[model samples]
Target: MPVLAQDAPIRVGGTLPLTGPLAGVGAIHKLAAEVFVERVNARGGILGRKLEYVLLDDQSQPANARTLYERLVTADNVDLLMGPYGTSSIIAAMGVAQRYNKLLVQSSLGDPSLAPYDMQFPALPIGAEPQITDTEVLLDAYAGMATPPKTIAFVTSKFPSALTIAKGGQEVAAARGLETVLSLEYEFGTKDLGAIANRIKAADPDILWSGAVGMEAVQLLDAMARIEYKPKRHFYLFPAPGPTAAHPHAEGLTTLTWFEEHEPFLANAGAADFVAAYNERAKAVGFPYPHAEYQAAAEYAAWQILAAAAEGAGKLDDAAMAEWLRANTVQTALGPRTFEGKFNAGKASTKLKQVQNKQWVTVWPADLRPSGSQFVAP
Candidate 1:
């Protein structure tokens, strides 16, 4: 029950999984928001007031996120609201934001379809919709190969985010005339990846896709290797960063994401400034400063959106900000984007990348594609 001071600051609030499974992600999001606050305040603050972000630790639990969000709006009285990381946490917080009608801006919650949630939960989610460009790029990349994969297998986790990704992939695959050889669902943290991998090998699919998170992606890869079953292309929705999946057997490992480093040309110096300031503060407190971390960049972009909308609206009211979202486009670090009623109303920001030669190389989204970064087969 932390208390907010009766100070003149544009107080924003959200939940983060700061102490549980997703603590690393939560820490990055918090770092981004804090860095944004520091940078903005240094530039005379927002509307003559410092921006204050009140992030609560939801412990990577949706139930805790919902309650904390309720407390954020009802008890803490946050002036503006933001969504938490991951789909389930965001979904849980969305209802709370809607109940209060706060201008809810989202960053990392990457389900392209907010329509179903609108119908099911009946909340007006007002913010930039995540551009889910990775799935299509994935299917198309596979389709372009000399001998395109005709059969696909979906190895998915039961997490809402994973399910959403799996569903989106299935729809895209079906449209592309690819047959579903096997669609397997496993619970996250289930110690049965070997069994799932065995099933996948038995199915003998051409392309293998997994909608699991972090270490699960590695586990699946390990299982596939142990069984000596390799697909033409293995698309993992979430991957642990670095060269962990770049070994010979892991050659074809892939993931569609906007979470990678933004091209140098597209990089925003303002974002860099935030990083500089963030690093300074982190160094002072002995906290690690994640430089150029994609998740942090995305959350920082959300703060930029809020600042632009608040300035454009010339008020702190949610509806006023909503109006601003309707009319104005903001040049975020990611790119030029406008809110298409809580969605990316423009081109998607996602790209397909693969682990090649122990490095993550961008292979799709024609504008960002690099030389020799071909969508080479697995």
Candidate 2:
């Protein structure tokens, strides 16, 4: 390998939904990425060169993401690319990365199957088949209850990833002998959830599975509250952590998580420090939920993977970085992640978390739960 000049900073460019529907959670990713870069540069940077992150707002639009990422690669001439926040945007960025044969380390892509690009690597630990693996994890937690749910009602978003996961959950429920009383699908950005809430209240199943993202979960819960209908139990697929936790109806609201600001998870190398840094940054910006959770952890982990690949390869070469990531496990805030599976995905280390006492905490998989935390019956 030829020696590269250290006078210039290595730029990593990407997009985030900083000012749109997904902005709430996208802010978490943005803050986390900022902290990661700050810490990395403070520690002498990557391969002795300073690290620079070039971020653009996609406004939660896939088409905007496609255009912005093209600008990052062609116009700005970024040396590396970081993947965007949502599934649709990530897919758009992936196309640009594939075209340029660059390594894309992404955090929040909902659907993994859509990523056919070999250079793309996922930082979220949802595994290659989250539709099956994630559903199984949730159902497994439910099964540990004294009286397991016998019937379920699924309210899904027509968003590509949510639809796929919701349909897969129905199959997994049937296989587990859980009857589906009612299943509903609505447009991705539906605001008025009254009619859907009314129908769900009418069905009144043992558990309600909502494939909601961003503020959709809060909207559904509020609509249900208006109708005086609260299911015995409920699970949200990809909710915005802060908003969902702050909602009054979100207590005991279950969701999937790979990291939480608690023991075991915080025991990972640099996890506690990252949490402290994120809390300070989030609080400084007047963020509602100032605690570090799965979203922040995943975003930090994505940066960790990129840095690890670059350092391990001893350069900022895209192919060399991807090769290094495939050959070794990167220690991340979510723990050690190995990109050995399909599309450079790691194992499905999904854990169940819930809002307890207005805080998101891991409660399932007894062993990984906080000292006194246990799965609360909803």
Candidate 3:
């Protein structure tokens, strides 16, 4: 009953945590979606149908997402949908889409348990397979180190997505001959990470992997700094796209990412232009994150992929659009990608990135794009 509408528009609906624990990233996700919708509609809507994205606030609660998704599909009868910001919310959204047999594209989900519904496309390059790391390209970074870290520790959040990644990392790291010195999962919104940091420092692993989101990461990072618990190397998710990278404690920190600049695959594509557009608007609005942080490129790529599918289908038929996507790869801001399972296939798949001199730079896969800095070995 509580929603926004546009007359005769091709309604694209979703749920995001506009307020709550995930509010920071949720706002960026919503902006990226709206930017894509706005751009597509400005250029004569998808398949000549104006896009009206009606996003409901899930309040960062999976249960709220369940109810909100039902409203989008059953009551509002939106034409298409996009998944919400995190794993649980996305799973909730997927359920609603599957029930209605509606076409849905998702971003920001990486739990292996939910990967079984491969029916819903994922917007990231991660898999839920047992013993499979979130992004092996990153672990390869560790293995390739001249004096590679021999021991690794995982400090993670209790969230399902982080848990899956940590589990996979533990398996993969052990297989890679790295000792698992310590593995700890902290409750979300943990106020003080003193004990966690102390434990990791005591373990004194050469490598530390953080499974915390942006806020949780800050807690752990701050505590690490307080205790001077800098591991030989540190990699984390979240806070990858925000000002946290500039934090003094984040110097030489590393994380895996989906996008950067001068990707040969997208050298002459419209990807740069799309990024520029989002960057300009975001900067104007005083948004601190770049395109990478907000996932603007990937989300816009999803829109581009969906639009191409709609044009290929030549009507508002969800099945036709889905079939087209399965059979062909489309050029998106992310690069040429096909829904070959959970993630879209692309050349610049993932990057091992590090913070050097307060800037995030790529350090591996050597060819994706030069980080213009050497890997600061720990």
Instruction: Put down candidate 1 lDDT per residue, 193-302, tens digits, no spaces.
Output: 88988998898888888886755776777787888888767888765443234455667577765534546523663655655665566556544332444566677778
Q: Give the per-residue lDDT digits (tens) of candidate 2, residues 247-292.
A: 9888888999999998888888689999999999999999999999
Compute the lDDT of residue 341 as modeled in candidate 1. 38
Candidate 2 residue-wise lDDT at 202: 94
Per-residue accuracy of model 3 over 244-285 as CA lDDT, tens digit each? 676678888888766665455345246666667777777777
In angstroms, what RMSD does candidate 3 have relative to the true structure?
Answer: 3.4
| Cα lDDT computed for each candidate against the true fold | 0.69, 0.91, 0.72
Among the numbered candidates, top lDDT falls to 2
| Residue 20 lDDT, candidate 1, scale 0-100 | 70
How does each model score on TM-score?
0.83, 0.97, 0.91
Total clashing pairs in model 1: 2
